[model samples]
Target chain A: MIRRRFALSPALLMSLALAGLLIVVVLDLPPQPGLAGPVAQAMDQAGVGHPVTAVLLNFRGYDTFLELAVLMLAVLSIWSLGRRDPIPARPVQGPVMHGTLRHLIPVAVVTGGYLVWVGSSDSGGAFQGGAVLGAAGVMLMLSLPREMPMPPALLQRLGLSLGVFAFLAVGTAGLLAGHGFMGYPPAWAYHLILGIELAAAVSIALTLVLLFLGGRSRKVRHDR
Target chain B: MTVDVISPQIYLLCGVLLFVLGLHALVVRRHLLLKILAVNIMGSGVFMLLLGVAARGEGGIDPVPHALVITGIVVAVSATAVALVLMLKVKAATGLARLPLSGPED
Candidate 1:
């Protein structure tokens, strides 16, 4: 009973310690608010004129594009390792996964398309929506386990390169226009975001899926 | 509602439970995939704590940390993919998962 009584006392002591620490820190710290560094300042500035998408796709679009290329190089390195055993195609048949996909797949595809279409305006966009659709594909792959044709090699490469290609193309287009690389001089933010989102979705989805499949190693054994 | 009126008993208890669960999974699970899952659970626990910080900061919720969390999700997925691939290769070659067993007899 004494120990039980003191347990509450210890709890009170702990809370008091926390309160004291809070007061100490509040009194001791400087009152300056907002970002303390240049990088954060830059991010805030870039994100202000447009949604986070514009900052990612246009303001620092060159780096964003380069980042995708880096992902491509990783994929290419895997291919160069001489490990390209493609999965054979499988026939499709099933009650369909969770019955939800029956509703969700179409909805996700439409949403992805809509995001690609209206990417400049809202929370929904190609990157976010495409991932959703790709998730539908992953869901399909998991559920059917039998249906769906294996993705062709060229299509895979195209998917991998799509983001970089679009990024560079847009940047070079800007350069040719005398605005410099990735420049959005005249209110072309919407167009640029669209390109980035479209390419990025495909690139990210394919790269993610391929990464999943790349680990299998064939074994050879001979013994009677 | 007044801040003092609220009790943090559940959140703290859940945090501790999640933390211990992650640790248990990491130590006891043999499957590399499951261990990674446990690591993710631990990461989530830390994320929960960081979110609590964001919640309590004098300023309204910090967008910077939220953005960083978004970026972190992608990075975590990539790292997990890479680690799983490495584990699979090691498993294929050795035909056994995880570091070799430790024992009193060598």
Candidate 2:
């Protein structure tokens, strides 16, 4: 009887070789020296104290606006494909999970709120805050029975679109004021950035939950 | 002599390896879900690489690239979510998790 030989696929071998070569080349390169840019000057003009947030929401607001639009577009396309029913009812969880969830959810909410507020001054920002809130939503969904009622569809839709709408409205206002689109006056910059971040956090959180749900549902049902 | 193990080159090398692995998986994997995951891994690699580059700047890490990577992360997540949804729809319609090797029948 002839036996078949097992060997690595040619493609896999080639890829591994390439990766090894890449590592060699990358290591040989000298350490890169830091380059100075307009960040220092821009930081002074940026409304927020956090340099990264200032760049995201002020210096490159246009990019952030488009990013939010892209997120909204993703949700729209998912919804258009078809509605998916919420997860089916599951057996009741033990008291341990129930107790944990009850405590966990409030902490998550407070932490998320703190992140959003702290974003103006430090490393935290809207996205981090939004992610925290989204996690909370996911946790709630898991803890509650499938039969639990969700918020009204209209409210859900508004939440999904809030970021994009807020972004556009602000940008358009800038255009009307002759500062170019998404451009903000120095005096109003801080307030405008904060407002936009607030709206964006809400939209991001809701959109994330909707994405996890996979599609729209007319109403969520409670398992009990 | 102490060699810095946590240098930017190490991070860059890791990113490169991850990117190649993802690319290989993308090319070889037949399952739609696996392909989607591979794409996400590739995206993460790019993010890592960008962050590594950002670390090289003089006074401190560049805020610009850090901001860009943060934006990229959200975009990547949104794109992945959409891709997963589309894959599910495809599965629902055809009852197949993997795409056909040949083009669709005319």
Candidate 3:
């Protein structure tokens, strides 16, 4: 038999060439001090001890606000698609999964809350906490024997919009008070940021769980 | 002296490699799920690049990039959620989880 020729796919070749160029560029770059100095200088005024949290919630609060809006839009788009098909029945859960979940859900809630509270001075934040909460919700959705009914539509909507509304209210109040839009007075910054974080964490968790569900509430009429 | 590959710049190289790999997969793969995965890989590569760049600061890591990456992660998750739902809707309508190849006109 004739020896098989080795084939070189163009995609692989192109990717390799691109990677090589990128590697060369990255290696050749000079080191530069970033915004760390300015951030440190302004840390006291930022009202949060953690630099990352200061940047996220105080310095660039609008970005975080818009991010929440984007999350809301995603859920809305998913809901517009159609109602989720009913989850198929599964075999009864074993005691291990049941017992594990019973313990884990409470722990998850506490951990999520702790993460949000600790975010001001630590490495955790609303998003991290919200993700943990969302994971808990997903676990509940997957493991629960009976179909979990969607919460009342109005209540769910309230939770979904809570973050944005809280952000807007704070921003608008700032504007009216001459602190500028989204600006917190130095003394009030920490409390305001904390409040926003709590609301955002709740909304983010709800949005994530809704996204996982992947459709509108079953109570709503399906319109396609 | 051997080139130092263990520095933070190593992440930059990995990031670029990841971006290219994901791009290649995105172009070569036909399945919708693979496309979604490729896009996420590309996002991860960008995040890695940001972190790597942030690490280059002489004093301490740049908090701005850290914040940006955090925001980006949430945005990426929302986008992926929408994409997955769209993929499902496409499958429901077309009975195929892929796009129709548009070949050159005869």
Candidate 4:
């Protein structure tokens, strides 16, 4: 088979031109303060010490809520495709993988918990922490034998919906209290934010694990 | 002038290059896995651009963009998962992991 010599295809040329234009444009962005000033001004009222967390969980809670919903929707779509294929069993050369998983899982749990907690005052949050936990779950799933049973369907469903449910509950409460949707009473802001983060973290982790699993498990009976 | 100084402009340029490279790959690559990876690279470029912009604030790095980027990352992950599952279904149904070429010359 004759391999075609490399040439500047139309696609390559177009992308190259586009890159040039974008590079020139991005080099001189307008000098502006951005939202940092506004975010700082409202930090006292936003409840969280960390600006990013305050923005995500308080000022822009609706976005986070919708993000969780999107994640759930992805899992739903995957389930609609078909039941999950069991993870293939690959023989380990030694107990290294299993031993590593046993040691790492505990550490991951602790780190994930710490990340969620520190998110209120630092550069960590539900997504970061949940990713760690999800990785741990994936490891667990990969190491398990083919006959190993997954968690109960009901329990899985609960975990998947926990984030969205918690966010909605908080938002509705705010609406009822006339603080507007997703608004926490200033006094309860910290607690509400923390509660939502914890729930979101759990949901995110479970959702990621499920996504990795690729579809619903057939072994677990689904009640109509 | 010594070229040792780093700035957000460097990040912006790199991001643009990455996005363009991904777009080029997406157009040329026939493999489903390459397409997915190209899309991810495109997303990373966008994320990088957002971060560069966030760093442009006078007082400090902007929080709103940071929040938006976080949201975007989650959305990207969700999209990639859906795409992967869809790819598998396509593979199972068609017995090919690559897209059919539209052009006859190849």
Using lDDT, give the best candidate's number.
3
| TM values, all candidates | 0.64, 0.90, 0.93, 0.94
Give the per-residue lDDT digits (tens) of candidate 2, residues B56-101: 6666788888888998999999999999988988888899988788
Q: Write the per-residue lDDT of candidate 1 for residues B12-106, one digit (tens) a residue.
A: 33444565567666765677778888888776765654444434434444444433444445555656666666666678788976765674578
Instruction: Evaluate model 3: give its lDDT.
Output: 0.91
Chain B vs. true chain B: TM-score per candidate: 0.74, 0.90, 0.90, 0.89
lDDT for A38 in candidate 1 is 32
- Ranked by TM-score from best down, the candidates are 4, 3, 2, 1
Candidate ranking (DockQ, best to worst): 4, 3, 2, 1
TM-score of chain A of each: 0.63, 0.87, 0.92, 0.93
Model 2's CAPRI class? Answer: medium
Q: Report the lDDT tens digits of candidate 1 across residue range A1-224.
A: 13344444544555446545544543344433322233344544342233445445655566566666666665655444434333455435446445666888788778767766665554554456666666767766656544345566677778878888887887888899887888754556565667667777778777766665563222332121
**Shift of residue A5 alpha carbon in model 4, Å:** 5.0
Highest-TM-score candidate? 4
List candidate 3 stretches off by more than 4 Å: A1-6, A89-91, A220-224, B1-5, B103-106
> Which of the predicted structures, 2 or 3, would earn the higher TM-score when compared with the native?
3
Residues A90-136, model 2: lDDT tens digits? 65888888899989999999998889889989988889999999999
Worst 10-residue lDDT window, candidate 4 chain A: A85-94
Q: Considering only N, C-alpha and C atoms within 3 Å, which residue pairs clash in candidate 3?
A: none
Q: In candidate 4, what are the lDDT values of residues A1-224, reduced to their tens digit? A: 35567777788789989998998888867878899999999999888899999999999999999999999999999999999876666455358877887799999999999999999999899999999999998888777544446678899999999999999999999999999999999999999999999999999999999999898787664332
- 1 or 4, which is superior by lDDT? 4
In model 2, the Cα lDDT at residue A149 comes to 66
Error of 1 at B61 (Å): 4.6
Off by over 4 Å in 2: A1-6, A24-36, A89-91, A218-224, B1-6, B101-106
